[model samples]
Target: MIDFKEKVSETLSLRTGAEVTIEWRINIKGVMTGWCRLREAALILPAAEAVAGLEGRLSMITAYLSDSAKQKGVREIAFHFDLDGTTLTLGIELPLEGARIPSLTPLFRNADWHEREFMELYDIQVIGHPAPRRLFLDRSIDPAAFERLIPYSTFSNGANSKALWEKVMARSGNNRKELQ
Candidate 1:
């Protein structure tokens, strides 16, 4: 497990040429939960390492595909790496704006539906995917309308939890006392 994490960290650092954060959480069953995040693009290495490391432990990997907003025209892809004991799930969030889907079918055979789902839901262009078709979205809906439906936000959690909770309770319908 340690070797796997190290490999991923090294590869991501080398490929993206950015600082990558590596996190590992061991569940009760002693299964390792690993994740790496890069500021820019660091998809291939991280994906490859996760697959390689969790080969025996992985059961399935599910990709949740989406894209950036239409206005920006900048592609932002995010991947959720899940290593289920039986199946490893890799949830890939494609950019809604200027979306480009990299072909993972060649590397991971299970990524076909994932790519399809992205194409269907967010109208992302999945290049080189063997079968690039709609997975969940209705064929009736126009592609332009579908793009608007996708949520666009930059997510970050570097705030004080206690303070944030107090503010939340104050605004909530139920007026509960804040815990000090």
Candidate 2:
């Protein structure tokens, strides 16, 4: 079977002279499962179209927006495609500063909600989204409030609980220094 990466690359090269770079992925068990990635976020539409032409089905789309992403100066969005019984993920990197990417909802119905979610949470504008409205957050909630919420890494029990307790105590002027 032709690897999805090669197929996607070849198909896209024929359609457009753009290059699609593939990075092989290894599962948790250390087994090389598949390869993924295509082009920058700006060129994602053409790469996605090529995958679609190969009879690939869009499974889901996810956006990773965090302090780390901001630090790296990248906005990574992954488009998961089921191509010929193999799962292929196309990751596109956009600039973190004032990020804007063309919406895929015009071509794929499944892209609607995913794009909206990214727009609301990450503050990355998805231009041309059909329903350009708040998905989870209403108007009352501050747009940047999403970032203030606890990140997955800091959401654990023991250490995070102690940190939270210390923070509250410090704010209430009941910290160790004040108590002393």
Top-lDDT structure, candidate number: 2
lDDT of 2 by residue, 1-180 (tens): 346557666886665567655665656764443455555666777767777788877778878766787788887778887765566777777886777888887668888888777676675778888887766655644453344584433433224666567767877888878456
The pairs that clash in candidate 2 are: none
The TM-score, computed over Cα atoms with residue i paired to residue i, of candidate 1 is: 0.52
Instruction: Put down candidate 1 lDDT per residue, 40-158, tens digits, no spaces.
Output: 33264455554555453223333333333334544444554444442222333345446565666766666677667656545466678887755655464445334454322111121
RMSD of each: 14.4, 7.8
> For residue 164, what is the lDDT in candidate 2?
63
Provide the overall lDDT of each model, using Cα atoms, as 2-decimal numbers.
0.51, 0.69
Looking at model 2, residue 141 earns an lDDT score of 49
- For each predicted model, how many residue pairs clash, with residues at least 3 apart or on different chains? 15, 0
